[model samples]
Target: MKVKCKSKSAFVQPIGCMMLSIISGMGISPLVLAVPRQVSLHSPEQSAQRQPQKIAQASGTDTPQRSQLIQQANALYSQGDFKGAEENLRQFTKKFPEDAFGHFQLGNVLFQQKKSEEAISAYREAIRLKPKYALAYNASGMVYASQSRWEEAITEYKKALEINPNYGEALTNFALAMWQTNKKDEALSSLEKALNIFKTQNRGEKVNQVERILKEIKTADEPGVS
Candidate 1:
């Protein structure tokens, strides 16, 4: 699949986009939080900042309208109506600036539209609002990677990993960025972690992908290879 946002370099990393799935270690099946495919609404402040596990749980007790805005925005985003998603999300963030998820989704929409700087700003705002927001940091790192800004990308990915050590996406992205900077051992270590995460989660596709990456990396660095 053509990436939602392609990198400037020919060295495209597999599975580069952040998977906005049910967060692991939450004891919830990753199947539970399928945004865009089904609708779930909750006050971002109530659910997000308090519990990463309950990130997608709905109280239905607060911010119904705000939650609706996010639902509609996510729908628009899935339909490739990035402008419409942006409009709804802008309204959402304007009203509930503390909602890190809103800002992060808005950043995703902007990033899809190739508005890198605006996306970065939104990601930064999400990070500021929730310092432990691994998803925002990962998304920001992906944007940097797309621009071939390896150092910046590595920094953001490292921060994300520090916050959420089980975040497989960030680990893989971090490993790729590390490879770009010739940190061979660090890259290999991060990729191994990612592979283990995928294996433990039974995400066979991701495991296969990571294994491919590991092979490629090892091959490239072999004694006689370029």
Candidate 2:
């Protein structure tokens, strides 16, 4: 996709972007809280700040009016209406700033339009309103990672993991960041943890991506003329 953000920030690391492509290919899945004894290395926060709102559809009983607007914004987004989506989201926020999910979806649409700065701002607002929002942290991590801000991206991903230890994307991205930082062993370890988590989650595409990177890294590390 063509990213057209207001900021002129360049990509942080090719590896991170590659990982993002892998995750994107798999689709964004809503995270579910893990039961105790999942044997996960990381642990997610239960309530960082905000409560997720119910996503009422256009035909939903209550908030039919708001639902109509959300549907309109989504349609505009689907039609490549970045500006329109922005407007709709802004209006939506004005009407319901407490709606963390609304801000998050708006941020997603902004990111899709390549409005990195705007997307970041929207995501920050989402995080502010919902501190426990692991997904918001994940989204923010992507924005930072795309800008090659490896440290910031890592921080965001870590925060996401802290909120939900089973957040596969955060784990995978964190591992990718370590790889980009040249921490080969650490990267492999992180990826291994992620792969283990995916085994039960059925995130096959993501597993394949991580495995691909691991193979590439191993091949490069073979004893040879260096």
Candidate 3:
């Protein structure tokens, strides 16, 4: 997803136009948290930061009333008012059951509330309403990753990538899942691709983060190194 950074305002601003991407194919699910060799899987802060922007962008075609409701929910979420956001989103979704973005935004609020199962359900509904909702797939994958369901996470990431190959956030997350599943080589390869994409997109922060991960993976892979 692309987030354009904005100046500090009274309400929480949506993710700036900066793009966030994820990672690919893997197997072997573990119940325990699978610490990646390099880079963490997902960041709640980052996810929260991006929600408003994504919701705004995706809601362009929504009715003004629905749009306002979504905006309110986004603001509430940004302000850390999870319950308020949840209530607003629930109302919004109830009013617009077919609105994919509404479901997606609801998922974001649920995720912030640490309601993983509910978040997944919301994301799934979003995807079901919009079969090609790559971000929904990516978000659902994140939930799976948090549960240490690496295989499931990878599957979700791959679906996101299939919809948009240059989805940087999905690529990065996919790489992380691969690494967690003990597929270091594959993870490094995916990271390299993600790094290149981020660089091309002029996403300096993501490029730097991916570079650091690449360095860590390479260092670990070096002969005689742990």
Top candidate on TM-score is 1
**lDDT tens digits, residue span 1-226, model 1:** 1234454354543322332121111111211222432534332222323353234334332366776886788678668788998999899889877676678778877877889899999989988877888777877887787677889988898897788788777788788778767678998999899888777767776787778778777877467753
Where is model 3 poorest over a 10-residue stretch in terms of lDDT?
A: 26-35
TM-score of each: 0.75, 0.74, 0.73
Q: Candidate 3 residues 1-226, lDDT tens each?
A: 1122345334321212221221222111111111122223354323423443355456664566876786687578667787998899899889888777778778877776678899899989988887877778888898787665779999999998898787777778888778767788898889899888777766677787778667666675467653
- Please identify model 2 stretches exceeding 4 Å from their true place: 1-20, 23-51, 55-62, 223-226
TM-score of 1: 0.75
Query: RMSD per prediction, one decimal?
Result: 6.8, 7.5, 13.0
Candidate 2 to native Cα RMSD, angstroms: 7.5
Q: Could you tell me which 10 consecutive residues in candidate 2 have the lowest summed lDDT?
A: 30-39
C-alpha local distance difference test of each model: 0.67, 0.65, 0.66
The lDDT, on a scale of 0 to 1, for candidate 2 is 0.65
Cα lDDT tens digits, model 2, 145-221, are: 66667789889988988888877677777876776677778878877887777766665665777688667666655
Which parts of model 1 have CA positions greater than 4 angstroms off?
1-62, 222-226
